[model samples]
Target: MVEIKEKGEFRYIDEGEGDVMVLLHGLFGALSNWEGVIKNFSSGHRVIIPMLPIYTMPLKKAGMDGLADFVERFVETMKLDNMILVGNSLGGHVGLIYTLKNESKVSRLVLTGSSGLFENSMGGSFPKRGSYEYIQERVEYTFYKPETATKELVDEVFETTKSIPKCLRIVAIAKSAQRHNMAKDITNIQIPTLLIWGLNDTITPPLVAHEFHRLIPNSKMRFIDKCCHAPMMEHPEKFNRILENWLENEAHKAA
Candidate 1:
């Protein structure tokens, strides 16, 4: 069973037991993005999915550094030690930044379709009041297989984007990403790292993953063919299998 708990300004889903695995979601996403893989992961490890403050409930205007600071506080608040941080998109970026600052606290790192290393080609212009068609187009852009952009998914995202406040929040996040550059600091990360990418990801693309692999000395990269930005959602089974194997290898080495 997944138990929801609120700690200060953040809300998180806590489930299972053993060494901690904290999953972070990207922009326009919540803990549910990991729903497909969470059960499998939770069976063997404690899974904690925290709702990022800026994304969910912004206390103030924050850039990447501010958001990274929030993640640090969340870790301290949860008393998490030697965590395996798995993040997608914005979440992955935050995880990378946090791990760079607090290397000893992270046992391993997993980044999937992460941002922050390079400037996004998808410019920062967002509609003030997005229509269903507009929202659908944006959602469809994330997927290489257009069929994966189901009506339900598009509608869900559309509802969220309809809110003016949410739109503004998204703008804030885009600006933060534009100002921060993690590529220069990625080499400083000393923890075991894994980079997962969807082979057809147009948003971040496979080249971004290659750069991450090159920068992090002790890192490995895996690509899911015919997949797009959200592989954890689009190809959970394969994604989970890769993750399970990597985690097992890391554990063996540690043992």
Candidate 2:
């Protein structure tokens, strides 16, 4: 276990043996967000989850922050090579950007309700505002089923928001939002990719998954029934099964 700072924020990280798998969390999410997923994978693979620093503090430097650079620094700092990338929501978007910019580091890629893939897929992205209420509303939209949207879920997100200042949150989104066209960059990825989407996801809908599959070469899409944006939390068993199957197949193909 090791704790390190990249771009001025502390991130918790753990390293183990087997094929390396880097787990990336969504916007407003820290490494803790992927705790369950990491537990499941760590038994079989080396897992590394980096806390994205951009979404932490309230104040930030001006202009769009370099997401690509952050990823580069992370890879170099960890001394990682030839690994699979698993990212959810905004993390998925970041994973895609990192792979696109540094294809040499990635082996296989998996994205869950990934944000960076589609522009108009989910009734267009959220509005260009930074209010806590506005952010809360947008965050709520990421889920597929309203029934599954509970008070606890909303409160958890609220807690994360309260931890980070409004200004920094706005800057992170602003920089990511500035380059919303992930489709154009998909062609750059050479590694085989897997996309898992929630069937009920309204934020990044099933249609977005299909579009990503259609655009990215050598990519496959799987939709989990009754799940929304956060499938790992909403449906962990099914999500794990899907991941296990894809990984096994990828392993066979490589052999």
Work out the TM-score per prediction. Answer: 0.93, 0.81
lDDT of 1 by residue, 1-255 (tens): 467798678789988898899998888676778987788888889999988875455636555777788888899998999899999988898898899899999999999999977635333346446577777777788887888888888877787778777767777777778667787888988889999999998878799999999999999999999898889999999999999999889889989
Per-residue C-alpha lDDT of model 2 across residues 1-255, encoded as one tens digit per residue: 245444434365765578898888866565656656777887888888877655543344322235555767878877889988998877788788788878888989999988775533324543333355654566566655555446666566566555535545644565555466677778777789999889888767788899888888899888888787889877878888899999999889989
Best by lDDT: 1
RMSD to native for every prediction?
1.9, 3.9
Winning model by TM-score = 1
Compute the lDDT for candidate 1.
0.83
Residue-level error in angstroms, candidate 1, position 220? 0.2
Lowest lDDT block of 10, candidate 1 = 119-128
Kindly report which residue stretches of model 2 are placed more than 4 angstroms away from their true locations once superposed.
1-10, 56-65, 119-140, 144-153, 159-168, 171-175
| TM-score, candidate number 2 | 0.81
Query: Which 10-residue window in model 2 sums to the lowest lDDT?
Result: 56-65
